[model samples]
Target: MVEQFQNHITPDSQWSTYEANVQSYRGLSMSAQSLYLAVGAILLGLGDKVPFFTVFVLAMVTTWYVFFPVIFARTAVVDFHKFNFGERFSKDGALRTAREDSKLSERAYANVLGGRRLRANVASNIDMPPGQNFRTMRQTRLKLDVFIPASMTVVWCIFAVYFAVFK
Candidate 1:
């Protein structure tokens, strides 16, 4: 069992998979935003030819259809990476090696583990909250992933209502 676990710790093994997922997450996120903008521009260019309600429905549908799947996929990738990293880090020898090699500081290790089960060395000075101090990378990406599509959908809905009632 120990040998099997050690085999996965090599640079080309689990780390590579984590790196690939990070790349995929980035690509999917960028593609979602780009496609959203492109579709919005195309729909907006139609001007008065398209009915407001139709435009709104199309925009909402397109945003949700394109983005929600990407969001789901990214979430899955994140969850997998998180689980994999946590499992690897939990090994006694691995943790000791990481500390001795200065590969990861205590705070960084805690943050990557989502601030859970923090060691004494980490828990003292980094007193923000669980998942709060860990917001270095994921915070902005998650915000953009979820909010942009939702806000755009709301904008379309508002435009549709304004045209229906006022115009």
Candidate 2:
């Protein structure tokens, strides 16, 4: 397991990590939206049965607090890397990515899920301990991930309440 990501943690890894994170975050956000829509459909369809409004309100709360933050955090991290190190991406990136992947088995330890687990896996892949960029990536990824979800929760909760109470 450690051996798999041994090359993704060095200062040189910033670009690869950022690219991986950007791609992962996009998919995660879409998944969050899909989950929200699917669950909302099921709950709304219930209508008068099982106190559906209450169920929706609760589900929205969870999505706000739990689901969306996960996606947001990932986005913030990639955005930071892109903002500060935009040049890193432009120079020989595609070729580098191809070269990096050609090695295989020593890149990153990814799974069906992406986030903290993946960060740790990437860290473990590096030769030395993480530097400023790596640590910042993980910290922001952890901190902001939940913050965005909070706003989404509030907005959705308002929508749910409007329909349940006013509509």
Candidate 3:
């Protein structure tokens, strides 16, 4: 499989398919980070008027909104750091980057450009598996499912608590 990947990735044309994901990394990461962090801050701010439980519930809901996209963004970063550039994503599935030492099955890779072969480029140039979009309308739309309830959970918890107790 590794050999197959090397063969597939050797072509420069396939590399073009991944150009958007690779080039757009900054915007995608920034957008997701901004959306969740900003919304998280807003959720936290609304906490004061609501009950402690409500705040806690909001925090939990906030976790969902803040969590998955972060996982996606962070994974993209880590995945890219170990990015084989045109190769399929890491088979290991962890954030592990390419080895600096020529030890994986006695195979070693080093940057001819970076002087001192001991220093490796590691996992920073991973490409999105072909036919996949790192950032897309569908993925963005899915946020509605999370934010809808994640946001509503906060509102519902607030109103429920208010009418049940604060009323």
Q: Tell how far residue 57 is off in model 3, in angstroms.
A: 16
Q: Write the residue-wise lDDT of candidate 3 on 22-138 in tens digits.
A: 445435434554554455446555654345445445445545555444433433333333444223323332233465322221122221222122222223322458776443213
Which candidate, 2 or 3, has the higher TM-score? 2
For each candidate in turn, the TM-score is: 0.43, 0.37, 0.28
Tens digit of per-residue lDDT, candidate 1, span 26-64: 566556556654654565555543554454565566556
Candidate 2 lands at a TM-score of 0.37
User: What lDDT does candidate 3 reach at residue 162?
Assistant: 61
lDDT of 2 by residue, 93-128 (tens): 221243343322212222224434544534343345
Q: What local distance difference test score does each model get? A: 0.48, 0.48, 0.40
In model 3, the number of clashes is 7
Lowest summed-lDDT stretch of 10 residues in model 1?
102-111
Report lDDT (Cα) of residue 119, candidate 2. 44
Candidate 1 vs candidate 2, lDDT winner: 1
- 1 against 3, candidate with superior TM-score: 1
- Model 3 regions lying over 4 Å from their true place: 1-3, 6-10, 48-117, 120-167
Top lDDT prediction, candidate number:
1
Report how far residue 158 has shifted in candidate 2, in Å. 4.6
Q: What number of clashing residue pairs does each candidate have, in the order they appear?
A: 0, 4, 7
The alpha-carbon deviation from the true structure for residue 94 of candidate 2, after best TM-score superposition, in angstroms, is 34
